[model samples]
Target: MSARIGVVTFPGSLDDRDAARAVRLAGGEPVALWHADDDLGGVDAVVLPGGFSYGDYLRCGAIARFSPVMTEVVDAARGGMPVLGICNGFQILCEAHLLPGALIRNDHQRFVCRDQQLRVVNDATAWTTDLTAGQVITIPLKNGEGGFVADEETLDRLEGEGQVVFRYEGLNPNGSLRDIAGVTNERGNVVGLMPHPEHAVEPGFGPDRAGAPRSGTDGLGLFTSAVRSLVSA
Candidate 1:
C-alpha cells in the first residue's frame, strides 16, 4: 500500500501544492490538509511547506502556531509521526516549541533566494534515512527571515545529541547560527529546515545544475526516506 503524506496549507501558504507534488513524485499518496482542520486524514507523514503564513504578521509563523490544525499535528508528532517543516513551517515549528530555537531576520537584512549547498549532519531521522551523513546536496532556499538562533546551551545540546540535521556546506545564506540549515526533535521524528527540498525534487525544473549529478533531484531523498520509513514501519 502506498504511504499517504499530508501537505498542510495555511492561509498565505503558497508551496503546499509543491509539497504535495513532491510526495506524489516520491511514490506516495498526497493528502491535502487545511490549516483550520482538526484532522490529519490519517496521513502517515506530514509536510509543512514554505510560504508566508498569515502574512508573516508580527513574526513568521508566530500566529500559525495557534492554528486549529496544529493541535493535531503536535499530538501526532509527539506520538512519533514524521513531520517535516520547511521555511515558514520551520518558524512555526519553533514558535510552537516543537523544535528549539527561533528564526529571526536575516543578518544581511535581505531576502535570499538561491541554490544552497547543505551538508547532512544526521541521516538517522525518519525523514532523512535515505541520505548519508556528511553528504552535501544543493537545494533551493528562499526566505526573508531565516536566521536561526538559540542560547549557547541549546546549540551545544543539539550538536551533541545529533539533532542538527543539516548545515550550510559552503556559505550561510541567512547567517543562521553556526550555519545551521535544519534541525530535528529529540525523537528524530519532527524536522524543520529553512531550505525548500520540495523545490529541488524534480529535474530540469529544480535548481540549475552543470555536470554529473546534474539532474537537480538531490532533494528527492527526503520524501522517499519518509515513504520508505512508513512502509517499513
Candidate 2:
C-alpha cells in the first residue's frame, strides 16, 4: 500500500506546499490538511511545515497549538503516529508538549539564513531511520527565534534517553542549548526541528555542497525515513 503523508496548512503557513512536494518526492501520497479541520484524512504520517502561524502572535505556534486539527494531532502522536515538525511546526510541537524544549529568540537577535550542517545524533527515530548516527547533512535553516531551551533535568533526560535526534555541527547558528538541532519524543514517533528539511529535499534547488554535483538532496533522508517506517509498521 502507498503511504499517505499529511502536510498541515495553517493560516500563515509558508511551506505547506514545499512539504507536500517533499512527501510526493519521497514516494508517499501527500495529503493537504487544514488547521481548522479535525480530519487527518487517514494519513499514515503528518508533517507540520514551517511558517509564521497566527502571525507568531502571543508566541510562535502558541495560537496554532490550539487549532482544532492539533487536538487530533496530539492524540494521534501519543498513539504512536509518526509526526514531524519543522521550524514553526517545531514550535507547535513544543507548545503541544509532544516534544520538549521551547524555541527562544536567537541569541544574536537576528533572523539567520544559511545552510547549516547537522549531525544525526540518533538514527533510531522513525523520521531518522534512514540516516546513520553521526552522519552529517546540510540543510537550509532560516529563522529568528530558533534557540531551544529546557530545564536542566529535562535536558539531561532527553540526552540520556537518546532523544536528541540531530545536533548542530561545526557552528551553532542560534545558540540552541547544548547545540541541539532536533529531538524526538520518548516513543521516537514524534520529531521536531528548526531547520527546513523540506527546502533541502530537491536537487538543484537545495543548498549547495562542495565537490559534489547534485548533492543538495541531503534532507531527502528525512522524508524517506518516514515512508520506510510506515511501510515496516
Candidate 3:
C-alpha cells in the first residue's frame, strides 16, 4: 500500500493543498489533517506546509504551536514518525520544541520571495534520502521570518551531528545563521526547512531552470524520498 502522508492545515495555511498534491505526485496518499483535531488519523508521515499560520500573529508560529493538533503531531514526531516542516511550518516546529533553534526576521528586515538554491549536506533524513550529499537543488522560498538562529552550542551540535541537512548554495536570502536552509532532529526522522519543496514538485508549474519556463522539479525528490523510506521500512 502507498504511504499515507498527513498534511496539516492551520487557520492561515496557504499551502496545505499544494503539499497534498506533492504527496500524491510522489506516489503517496495525502490525508487532510486539521489544526483543531487532536488526532492524526493514523497517517504514516506528516507535513506542515508553508504558510502564515495563525496570521503570523504574536510571532510566526507561536500561536499555532498551541493548536490542539500540534499535541498529536509532537507526540507522533517524537515516536519516530517522519515529519517535514516548511517555511512557517519550520517556525512551528521550533516553537513546538520538536526541533531546536528559532526562525527570526530576515537580516534585511523585509519579506523575501525567490527561487533558492540549496546544497544537500545531509541525505540521511527521512525526507531527504533521495538526495546526495553536496548535491545542489533549487526550490521556491518565500517568507518574512526565515532566518535560523540558535546558541553557539546548539549550532555546534547540529553541525557535528550532521543535522544540518540543507544550506544556501550561494546567496543567503534571509541571512540564516551558517547559511542553514534546513535541519533535522537527532534521530533524522523530523526535518524543518524554510523552502517550499511542494511548490517545485511538478514540471511546467514549478521554478524555472536554464531559461526554461517553470520546468524545474528538483523538489520532487524530497517527497519521493520519504515514500521510498517508508516503503523500505
Per-residue lDDT of 194-220 in model 3, one digit per residue for the tens? 999999988877778886544678899
Clashes of each: 0, 0, 0
Off by over 4 Å in 2: none
Write one digit per residue (lDDT tens) for candidate 1, span 39-66.
9999998998889999999999999999
TM-scores for all predictions: 0.98, 0.98, 0.97
Number of clashing pairs, model 3? 0
Output the worst ten-in-a-row residue range by lDDT, candidate 2.
Answer: 210-219
User: Native-vs-model 2 lDDT?
Assistant: 0.94
TM-score of 3: 0.97
- lDDT scores in order: 0.93, 0.94, 0.93
Clashes of 2: 0
